[model samples]
Target: MMKFLSFLLLGFAFLLTGCSEDANVIEVEHPEKVTVAFFEALYNEKNIEKAASACSPALARIIRHYRSPQAVARHMFNMSYDKVEIKPDDSGVKVREQFKNKAIITVYFDGYYQENRIKDVKRLSLIQQDNKWFIDKILKDPF
Candidate 1:
């Protein structure tokens, strides 16, 4: 009887341990981080897929026009940021005539393209679809 009880207790313990719930891990993406990641992927990593992941669908369409992914990424090598801001307006409801599914990110930076150093600001408009942000449009103010 003693041996039987020991086996039963061991089996019960194993069953209890196996019944634990799995850990739930959720990933949250911040707009500021996404902006930095976009540039990093474009320049440092030279990865078009990764960089394009940070853009909106409209931008993705444009990126496809390049001869290759590398060509698309090369456009960012001379870009450097000074400041960034994200404004999340009502992206779900019709209130005060705000956007329904978009966030505006303003990036102040220095553009050094073709040996021309220029202080400029680019506004990145992002859209949320299926819980992910994508670059939709880039509005640049020439310096």
Candidate 2:
């Protein structure tokens, strides 16, 4: 009788523990929207420092090596100097993705420059951290 009673108690304890577990409460965060927004802001002010703050925080190297906040801005500002010649056409970033502890973004701009037009061009990879994005490539061409 004692052996049977102990087995019953063990089963009851197991049941209780299983019932206490909260299995459907996992929370995941997506960082893509935040990154896209950062780029838009960068286009506006051309400030590398402000843009850096928008990245994932792991992009310190990228921000630090940009010559200076102003230099990076100059490039961005020049892209549209004559009338928004270079600008990103669109972005396809998604939500709730574990893409990488970091990420690489390929930027494509479309606009006009001195009667010259640019399209389907400009590629870059950005590393993300703590809500910041940093440039891994300033100018690169695969083709």
Q: Highest lDDT, which number?
A: 1
Instruction: Write out the backbone clash pairs for model 1.
Output: 55-135, 56-134, 56-135, 91-100
Query: For model 1, how does the per-residue alpha-carbon lDDT over 1-143 read when each residue is reduced to its tens digit?
Result: 99999999999988877653211111235554566566555544555666666776667667656645456634632343223222332245432236556766665544454556656455566676776666777656434
Give the C-alpha miss distance for residue 109 in model 2, angstroms.
Answer: 0.6
Specify the poorest-scoring 10-residue window by lDDT in model 1. Answer: 19-28
Error of 2 at 53 (Å): 2.4
| Runs in model 1 lying further than 4 Å from the true structure | 1-28, 68-100, 110-119
Top TM-score model: 1
Candidate lDDT (C-alpha), each = 0.55, 0.48
Off by over 4 Å in 2: 1-39, 55-98, 131-139
**Model 2 C-alpha lDDT per residue in residues 10-68, reported as the tens digit of each score:** 99999988764522111123333334444444554454555565543455446546655
lDDT of 1 at 138: 69
